[model samples]
Target chain A: MTKPVVLTGDRTTGPLHIGHYAGSLRNRLRFQDSHEQFLLLADMQALTDNAHDPDKVRHSLIEVTLDYLAVGIDPAKTTICLQSHLPALAELSMLYLNFVTVARLERNPTIKDEIRSRGFGRDIPAGFLCYPAAQAADITAFKATVVPVGEDQAPLIEQTNEIVRRINATAGRTLLPEAQAVIPPVGRLPGVDGKAKMSKSTGNAIALSASPDEIAAAVKAMFTDPQHLRVEDPGQVEGNVVFTYLDAFDEDRATLEHLKAQYRRGGLGDSKIKRRLEDILQALIAPIRERRAQLAKEPAYVLDVIRNGTAKARSRTEATKRDVVEGLGLFVL
Target chain B: MTKPVVLTGDRTTGPLHIGHYAGSLRNRLRFQDSHEQFLLLADMQALTDNAHDPDKVRHSLIEVTLDYLAVGIDPAKTTICLQSHLPALAELSMLYLNFVTVARLERNPTIKDEIRSRGFGRDIPAGFLCYPAAQAADITAFKATVVPVGEDQAPLIEQTNEIVRRINATAGRTLLPEAQAVIPPVGRLPGVDGKAKMSKSTGNAIALSASPDEIAAAVKAMFTDPQHLRVEDPGQVEGNVVFTYLDAFDEDRATLEHLKAQYRRGGLGDSKIKRRLEDILQALIAPIRERRAQLAKEPAYVLDVIRNGTAKARSRTEATKRDVVEGLGLFVL
Candidate 1:
């Protein structure tokens, strides 16, 4: 039996961090074994909001690729392709735009939230506003039945399905498949400061390639219960960054539960817990850092991986584009 | 010295009419000699508004191409290609969308007028709202310096120039040329009803391949001076559809002026002027109809013309896309 096709990717804005690992990459690693996976390096989508800083997107492509390699996303199992290199996606996007209304795009819950968060009022970039259609193109072009996204992003999957239904209805046949959003079991990983979600731009996250000392420093500075002034004082675990990291990274559930119980009761020091969390993190990231450093030296090999994967993706997508064009009775050359 | 490149096209929504001939095709015939011209069969643009009727757009491609050949537009001089086949245009359009804002696109007078006229309201197709960007892609992908547009469409050219400037500024060089709008000297041709502009959908248009009997019937049904009760009664020349067609088509200006004077002063009946108009139209349309009939027999040859021209266009536009991608520091595969 053929495995289900899965589409997932990162926006090439910066090197991904542990937040990406716990939230998505870890899930992607499992998908590679269980599914036919395509990992798109979404440089074009990155430009939707970062058009003025294309160099950042350009340079981050390698960094993000290295991060993927370091985290054990084997290229043999997962096809890693670049978004801008595939012309079919753009062509499909233009065609799909005619099927969706401007108001519908604006009313999309995902886009609306993003627009509000980014403070882009009426001056929103046209590409940013129309990205849902582009995303539909990407998902449908691959015929990927499964898409991994955050819970908040399920709306995007719905939008894609809406476009899928429209295209199929227009063609009088099922020309494309609707994608199901696979929400990861774990939620967002907070920054070391425990302020918000960890992101590369916020300067508070631990990259997968962080060195030994950097990992130690990030752990030392993690926020814990402020009212726990003394080692003997009872500490709250709900908002504590160190406890959160431990919850995400710790393999020994019984020992972590004991530690949490002790901390909640009394006499559990922040240093001791931070030391324990640091040990687990150091173990987690050390091999990844080494692997990333080794891969970083072979730039040509990494680019070749992208080039080969993109070529494969190009053929696959072009076939689908032709199918759609023919199904729509568009005059084909 | 290199000749300036001109970009021009007709929306493949219907066969070309006399309005299209008088308004643009005659000017295009002259442009083929003095400038390097690329004539786009704008099937993709037609989809923006006619997405519900892609079959019409598809069938009209041949009809419009036949019109071009029938009216003496030499494919050797003007590259005649299909818009949907050139992937570079779509890619460039997606790229340019990032350089402009949604509000800015909405504020474009050409788009605003079209939205109001179509009564699209907030339900405008995203593609229709963003066609100016697509048009920019069409013009700049060829690096065409001259774009033939109606006076009302000058704002679209302005929008294209804005995007050109933004792209050049982003690239830190002039990667794309700003296009100049070349408005045709003759204005819109009113319909035979003299109610509004001639249009195919309205069923008032005399197609370039109109039959002789059809031409005579259209001329006979044309609106004229309603108050001219007798041949001796004075007629109004200002709003007479026959006089308008005469001014547009009649080569003998002195004879036309004498006829107009006689009709206004008295003694020249509607039949006399109608007969003159019918004679001119039949002469003008007969050879075009015969050529159209001849060309329609060789569907393979017509398809080849589009195929060969589209292949040439694809290479040229791909080169430009590469330049823009490289100049913008986008990751190149």
Candidate 2:
């Protein structure tokens, strides 16, 4: 056979950062060579909470696209699509909605956690509640068999599987494939301020497309052990953000181990470690920043990439929809 | 300087009955000449509850269309389109979902009553809960100014207007027109069993496409005043089924008034009144039955009418969606 399809994407609510790179983007670079990859900029999903600020979502669509291109996600090998451009995804979502109950959606731990995190209380938007069904639409519309998602997003894939089984059972045919969630090896990247997660809203993220000066500043202010007060004092490596970045990005394993031992022995200074991290980050991000700057000057060409991918996406989704309509026994009229 | 648009439809769960004619179909025949009309065969909406039975919705699509044509709803003047064929309606619904909260949808009286009526309890489908948003999409997608509905369906119109205002305000432009509810003057045709409503599921309806023998059998079994036993004794015309049918269908005022007075004075028997009703119903439904039979012989021609109407509908909805995309400030990519 045929290669298994891998579907994944990020909501275009803000510019992607290194957190995204560590979590899923890095994994996609390898998966694209073996699988049929479809990367979506989920502008419609972003509107669930950011409905009042559509302009922000609109702008971030490009920002996130630039981040994807900067990270070496080849458009020729991977389809880079905008979620809202596929109207069939929305239609499939509506049909899938009939298969799930409000109670089932309410019981999803991922959505519940998100609601609590956002402090939406009892005023949760219906779109936010029903997003899993829409996500189901996105995955199954392409008949994706593998979905790359973070650990916290496991419930979303579970819900999609349920809808896939339900619709097929209702139609008495296997028209949709059940997708499996693939959690990335590096689950999360901590914020520069030592927070457990790096998020754009927290103002603690180093964006993938940051300039050299911006990267240097972010690395210099990176959080580390507060109690390692002096040049001679022992430093803790457990919760150190600088070491965490080093763990994720640094390729020299022997040098990193030697530095860790030196720091534990109470001779290495915080400034010395910060300077090392600064250099490594600049090396990683400099070329990416330059490529992004070059791509930024050609917005039309970037849009053409998305447009062409969307056309491919539409044809695939239309084929899926034809199966659904046939199973439903509805005449096209 | 142009005629306003009107949107109306039926959930294609069953064939259209005389109840439909009294409630909305009769009104549509008059409005189609003066306004642009779109009559939807809402197969998608039917699946909101009947997910397991796709065949019913699919079959009912044609049955409902035959009824519309039989009742003189001109396909030349009115667009008789299927809901599932218009993907834009679903897209609009997804966008509209962001503007309304889950709690707000839960509080909609129409949905609440439907849930209770269906005995769904806490197991209500998410699609069933979000149908008002879908209905809102259907109305605003065409920019319909008038919506013909029964008295019980008034709340559906209210919810549609709220979504329209919210979307237009959020977009910072009046891209959607607010729709007004138009309750038909002649409300309902009660069931032959004297029930308050004529429903297909209730097995008490006289279908618009019923044959002469079926019509005769249905009228012969109609419920009337049970206490009136003797031909010479006074009969009750107050809650009599025969008098109700005469009130709705019998156009000769003088003869109907005389028959009513004679029946109250005890000269007329139950059989006499039943025979009168049978004759009146046969005359009204004979041409409709004949037309439906002719149309049924040519299914391809009937399908063509729906296909052409759907194309016209698609173009109109695409124009509406363009305005929405522009207002959101999102690039096509």
Candidate 3:
């Protein structure tokens, strides 16, 4: 039996952090063994919001790829492709745009939430507004039946399915398959500052390639219970950044539970918890960082990986584009 | 010295009519000698509005191509290409969308007028709303300096120039040329019903391939001065459909002016003017109809023309896409 095809990727905007690892990367590692996976370097999607700074997106491509490699995403197991290199995706995007209405895109919960958070209002980039359709193109091009997305992003999967249904109805046959959103088991990891979700641009998250010193400094500054000023005072774990990190990264559950119990009962300090969390994080990131440094030296190998995967992806996507075009009775050369 | 490139085409939604001939095709014939002309079969653009009936766009590709060849558009002078077959246009459109804002696209007068006219309201197809960007892609892919458009469509040219400037600014050099809009001197031709513009779907258009009987029937049923019940009755020349056709078609300007004066002063009957109009139309359409019929018999030749031209266009457009991608510092594998 054929394994289910899974599509997942990150926008090439920045070096990914532990938040990405906890939320999706770790899950992707598992998917590589269980499914046929395609990891897209979404440079075009990054340009939707970062058009003025394409160099950033360009530089981030290698950074993100190194992150993927460092974290044990084997190139042989996962197809690592570049978005702009595949012309079929763009063609499919233009074709699928006709299947979706402007108001429908505007009304999308994911897009609406993003627009609000970005404060784009009426001045949103046309590319930004049409990204849902572009995403549909990416999903349908691969014929991926499983798409890993955050719960907040499930609406995009729905939008892709809508386009799928519309295309199928127009063709009087199922030319494309609808994708199911696969939400990862882990929720979002908060930033060290404990103020918002960990994001690359926010400068609050610990990058997967963070140096030892950077990790130590980040852990030292992590927000914990301010009310637990004395060693004798009882502490709260609900919003503590160190505890959150421990919950996400710590493998020894019994010790962590005992520590939490001790902290709630009294006589547990912020520095102790921070020290333990830092030790756990430093061990987690140090080998990955070292591997990343080693991989960064072989630029040609990285580029070849992208080139080969992109070439494979191109043929796959072009076949689907031809199928869609032929099914619609469009004039094909 | 290199000749300036001129880009123009019609939506492949139907066969070309007399309005297309008088308003653009005649000018295109002249441009063939002096300009590097590229005539596009805008099948992709037609899909923006006619997504539900792609077969119409598909079949009209040959119909419009036949119309071009029938009206004496020399293939050696003008490169006739299919829009959908050119992948770079779609790629460039995706790139340019980042340079324009949704509010800016919404504010474009051409798009606004089209939206209102189509009564699309909030339910506008995203592709229809984004067509200006796609058109900008078409213009710039060929580095076209001249784009023939109606007066109302001048705003689309302006929008394309805006994107060109933005792309150049982003590249820190002028990688793309701004296009100038060339409005045809002849105005829109009214339908046989005399109520609206001659359109294929409206059933009032006299197609370029119209038969002798069809031409005669259309001339007979055309709207004229309603009050002119008798040959001796003083008639209105301004609203007379026969006079309009004569003014548009009759080579002898002096004779047409004399006939209009006689009609206004109450001596000429509608049948006499209708007879004159029918003769001119038959003379105009008969050879074209015969040529169309002959060309239609050789589907392979027509398809070959499209194939060869589209192949040439694909290479040219791909080169531009590379330049833009490289200039923008995008990752080019």
Candidate 1 chain B: worst 10 consecutive residues by lDDT?
Answer: B195-204
Cα shift from native, residue B64, model 3 (Å)? 1.1
Error of 2 at A117 (Å): 0.9
lDDT score, candidate 3, position B49 = 93
Query: What are the TM values for chain B, all candidates?
Result: 0.97, 0.95, 0.97
Instruction: Tell me the tens digit of each residue's lDDT in model 2 across B1-333.
Output: 889999999998999998887778888999999999999889999999999888988899999999998889898999999899999999989989998999999999999999998998879999999999999999988999999988888998999999888888888888788999988887777899898879978889999988889888988889878877888778888778778878888889899999889888887888888888889889988999899999999999889889999999999987888788787676565
lDDT of 1: 0.94
For candidate 2, write residues A127-243 as lDDT tens digits: 999999999999999999999888899999999999989988877889888999998877688999999878878889999888888888898888888999998998998789999
Model 1 spans with C-alpha error above 4 angstroms: none
Per-residue lDDT, model 3, residue A119, is 99
Q: What is the TM-score of chain B in candidate 2?
A: 0.95
lDDT of 3 by residue, A63-88 (tens): 99999999999999999999999999
Better of 2 and 3 by TM-score: 3
What number of clashing residue pairs does each candidate have, in the order they appear?
A: 0, 0, 0
- lDDT, candidate 2, residue B35? 97
> Each candidate: what lDDT?
0.94, 0.89, 0.93
Every model's DockQ: 0.88, 0.79, 0.90
The best candidate by DockQ is 3
Docking class of 3: high
